[model samples]
Target: MNNSHLELLKKLADEFQPRTDVNTRATVEAESTDAFATLVDLARDMQNRLDQQQNRIRQLEQMVETDELTGLYNRRGFLRRVRETMARAARHPENGILVIADLDGFKLINDHHGHAAGDAILRHFGQNLRTHTRADDFVARFGGDEFAILLVGSIPEVAERRISDLEKATSRFPLIWQGAALPIRASFGFTVYNGKSDITQLLQQADDAMYANKHAKRPHSESSHNAA
Candidate 1:
């Protein structure tokens, strides 16, 4: 809610409340520091305004970090948060897993159906991914049709399970847009954090693994997407 609205409500509450047989003006005069009290009130008012400005600034920052399309973190937010998470995971006993995912036949989906339909699928898939992953896990859209999920304090099996669940989810629910049932196909490759000094190298490793898996399975359907 807006700060102005909050202030208005507070004003109404103060007016409605019943007060005892004590007068604010008489109290101020008895204190013999009316000027000082006024200064304190001014300072408090300034502080409230400052607090409101700070809250607005924080909201704006969150908007910057979020992806407008899918409500996931954009690449910048992903890198910023995941870097810290990975650093902590490196020191902790349990390691982390990074999965690089790309949608197969996404271009075709965009080409056949309008971009609106394409966006709908992406939003649905992104929300589903958010629901499926653990709360501590970080999910982000790495631009275009690519996404990344960082499973903090997790193992290879957790990443593997996510891939399997993703495949099963898409298969189970055929996305329907404009009276046409469309398949949400994707490919995923996972790389475990091995106490590497650089996190980008781990990302590169996952990307390479994804392509290798994609190429190896391309023969079956040429465009068949795999969650393997």
Candidate 2:
């Protein structure tokens, strides 16, 4: 029940109680019976309000953990799950894998197109990730153009393969903006956590791997100019 309703009920009950020992011993009258009935009605109303308040609280909690834009878990929600997964992994070892991914040339897409297009790309990416992953997997938008996925009961190899599959699926999905097809791609890096490692360190390793992938794919100045 909501605090306001509970407080009101308490106030009414306090006020209705006999103020003295002599009053408590007096015989009940029709007016007194009517007042008791009113109190019963008030109590029922208060109970209903309390039930509504509880339902509202659950909805608010869900919204807090979800991302409004991409419809995925936001950064705050993602970290909360990470902590929970880490705790579970500590107890069951080798049961969790963390993958970090970022869109390739996302800046170029934003610069060439616009923020609106960028947003569409992010939304599509999120949808694809959700579609390809298992129900037990946790996927979230870590930040702009960056996403993280936690695979429960998965090894690094399996996680990598899942990421690769997602990449291929995403590449095949064309984004139509302003009646034009925009090509999209992503790079991913992952590491397996066995419950013994710090969450921060594991994330860093994945991040490092991602950067290595990006650097390896980047063209040298000569190659760039030649292409131009």
Candidate 3:
């Protein structure tokens, strides 16, 4: 993770260096069967330590990137990957879509059902959504009840289909709690990324559009209510 850690690894690996003595007798003694066996055990121990440390490092990195509730990338992890995508897009021909989807009536879910139920639903949705996307796609919990998806190297039609598929996937089953089934709905906005702005700005644009789309839907309900 850092220069010091890397140096430690190198040091661990270099611990089994051959004994370099000018005396032929000393060299023969060092290379004896017993000495060889001891060196082998030391080498094995070093390898075991390296493996353990590497595994710990990987776990720490995952914790840094992952959202505790959903096991999806948090905003930090998402933006880190976004910067990579942006850099790639800058150098080559790129076709990508950024979709920001915010849960509708998420506050009601928390208020009515309690935070535990809300958390259960979020975890279920995250797992369900994982089944619907590709391996290379970037899926993240942006914050709160908002999720973001980056469809890399995809056309508008592909993006559109993916969105439709995702919506359908979520709607397929209501979130079941105890004996009750609760519906979950989300408002989504998607746009093609042209590398016109930085990663953060691009995300903001998608988010703005998502809210706009959400607001746009409110009028119909208002009109229906007003008519009644």
lDDT of 2 by residue, 1-228 (tens): 899999999999999977875555454565688899999999999999999999999789879988888999998888888888888878877577788888887877788899999999999999999999999899999999999998888976777788889889999997999999988788888888777778889889988888777667777653422221
Please give the TM-score that candidate 2 achieves against the real structure. 0.75
TM-score of each: 0.77, 0.75, 0.77
Candidate 1 residue spans exceeding 4 A from truth = 1-33, 90-93, 194-196, 220-228
lDDT for predicted candidate 1 compared with the true structure:
0.81
> What digit string (tens of lDDT, one per residue) describes model 3 on residues 120-168?
8888888767778889989899888889888888878988888888888
Candidate 2 backbone clash number: 1
In candidate 3, how many Å is residue 184 off?
0.8
Q: Please give the lDDT score at residue 220 for candidate 3.
A: 58
Candidates arranged by lDDT, highest first: 2, 3, 1
> How much is 155 displaced in model 2, in angstroms?
0.7
